[model samples]
Target chain A: MRTYGNSASVVVLLAWLLLPFATARAESIVLASTTSLDNSGLLGRILPAFTAKTGIEVRVVAQGTGQALATAARGDADLVLVHDPEAEAAFMAAGHGKTRVEIAWNDFLFVGPQSDRTAIGGMTDAVAALRLVSEAGAIFVSRGDNSGTDALEKRLWRAAGIVPAGQPWYRDIGGGMGAALNMAAALDGVTLTDRGTWLSFANRRGLVELVHGDARLINRYRVIELDSVRHAGAKLGPAHVLAAWLAGAEGQAAIGAFVLGGEVLFHPGVREIPPGE
Target chain B: MEEFVPIVLRSLAVSLAATGFAIAIGLPLAAALALGRWPGRPIVVVMVNALLGLPPVVVGLVLYLLLSRQGALGVLGWLFTPGAMVLAQTVLATPIVAALAHRAIEGRWRRYGPTMQAAGASRWRALPHLVRMAARGVATAVLAGFGRTVSEVGAVLVVGGNIAGFTRTMTTTITLETSKGNLDLALGIGLVLIGISVAVSATVLVLAGERR
Candidate 1:
């Protein structure tokens, strides 16, 4: 009787008292970014070096670009690393961000089943390819989460003068890029994705890159610090330090050096100027 | 396979810790609800049972607000940490624990109360003795709490931030892996989770059988 009752109570008490002690204590700063950037394993490659150099740990909260920007706007994150220049510009205009700097660049590649239902292979113009897919009645998966990729896809549809909404062939999945890609693979559907994620994603499920390398399909990543004045409680100093380090020479080199499956995922944004700036 | 070990272990550790805290706090609350005649005792019982139906994400969201930088407890700086995950799970599990524990102890309390009162025992004096008598059923309540906490993904992901090698847990990893099209890894982790849960349930069943 003593063994059963006392030991059970003792174990529970010890676990209750001792478990919090297991959590590690580290000075950390939060970085809200897109799932494409985080899921591509690029951050895992380069962040450790940054931490080694600065001893500042980065905690990444990966969501869609829109959600990431919203997190930064709420002062929930110290900084935001995301694509979608339009959203970034809007964030800056709203005075939520102190500064924005280009960190890296990748192109959007159209991926679909090798069956090529839309016959979009060898197409260099993304808008024309999208129009062809729409006209062909081929299934196209959209990352409907208001992500950078989703925004760009909408822009492409608008340029092609086609409303993909309400179409049976068009499915807007309100999820992350990786999820959209997975859905596309499962349905054997077409999708537009950042090259970094497309390259790093291992479960292709017979999907192939159908269209790529158009200037209109460029995906550029930028890091922005939340306005310190607006977010009085934010870790502004470390955020700025991390922003500078990311846009600096070392960071650019690290981005350029990151390779997956023998393919260079991103081109370091060393010399290229951001468009419409 | 190698990468999944830590995530599974983290999930177990967090859920177990949450269950431990839930039982510690919930058992006493349940005892009070069973034995005491308070003004709002019925409302409290109703509230506890209703809380068992509370969505984990809502709890996660509320806890997130309380733990965010601008939150009331933000000074502790536990947000986006493993500590935050445990806190969220405990908050989610406490009601389940209390509700089930109340049900378990209420029967024993009714049977024991009249006899103990006849023997000149106060409610407080009889509570400890009643809890000891209902220990087996209380153990089941604790197991149910553990199951609820471990299987939940919403709260832990929201509070833990799912940071790799830091706050990543089995359920969160399953969500991420499945979404990322890594079905094999997700399925593997899912199998392991089911195995562990089945093992816990089986152990409890065996213990109960032996007691019977």
Candidate 2:
């Protein structure tokens, strides 16, 4: 008020310009990111390096994409990294995440026991494979926790025209990917899991990837900076930095390199690069 | 609604099976701990006391790690199976039973012990009376454990896999349907769980009260 001669609008402009730089100097920036970031060990690997370079400690709170966005909306997190596009779009429309950037993209796979028992490989579609599992009454484990993976699973069920709510063969673990995968492994059932967590826990079970690269499998991830106006603690500057870095060369390379058992976890970016010449 | 019936039944089967196994193992073990006084008894007692309120998620995590196909017990093929779930529930319930029994037997040594000793009866004679006096409290413990085994969502969700018509239990069913925005099925399962809990408490109280 004193600097702007009691002008509210100019005071707002000054406040907007000054916050992130001052925040970077004084406070740690907290981010509520997704399970993929945490589970793939990307955040664990890169956050420390980012901190070492920037002198700003990035405290990444990891949760499922739905929960991460919801956490940001509640102002618990200054930013969010999420996978579910529809849910992410809803959050942006609601004025939560003001800046969004495609950070990485992966694919979901219908994984099962390696005996080729269901024979849904090369089917070129998710619904047909789901139907085969249903028709055969082969077991299928679901995350069922309303997570991003769970949401994707539900979308496929709609496409497959199978209401799996009460299906005897369908199992919903109502948990995170790790636990759900454990159950799927035990039962030798079909399940749709993120390639990251699946690969991390792959060797633990009898399960193998049955389907991938289908349109339904296109799992894209993005980072969004929380609108600081709505959230008092939003670290807009570093959040955008992180997001931009993720969409840049080094970050894309990191995404492609994140692996388990020598299998690439994510397919990096299919988004267009900038114009040349 | 018809589709969920089978799921509910499967959950009930798992819940009942876990409860039965808990009682089967917890009761005898609890009885032994309550009556036995030996070296490390206090330590065992303390550990059991601590485990009485163990969070379902923690138990689930330990069990998951131990039983995951890549885990140490993975070769046993128990992860996500009913057996692993039973093992987790049993671990959770055993401490509850032991703690309750320990508390029930806390102060009855003077009057009951002397009376039985004066009657020319052995340690066995005093045993039944101790059992009789502590019956109601022990029953409450069992009932509490049963309620927990049925109402728990985390452990079952983690360990049991909530497989419909397979490992799905009522608690996890309620969680799944509620999260999926299926209110009717969730409510139905919730109401059934409440009924089961009430029935269990009432039956234990009545039976224990009769014995006293």
Provide the clashing-pair count of each candidate structure: 0, 1
For residue B26, model 1's alpha carbon misses the true position, in angstroms, by 1.7
Question: Pick by lDDT: which candidate is best?
Answer: 1
Interface RMSD value for candidate 2, one decimal? 22.6
- Residue A40's lDDT within candidate 2 is 58
lDDT of each: 0.84, 0.69
Clashing pairs in 2: B11-B169
Model 1 CA lDDT for position B94? 92
Candidate of highest DockQ: 1
For each of the candidates, what fraction of the native contacts does it recover? 0.36, 0.00
Q: What is the interface RMSD of candidate 1, in Å?
A: 3.4
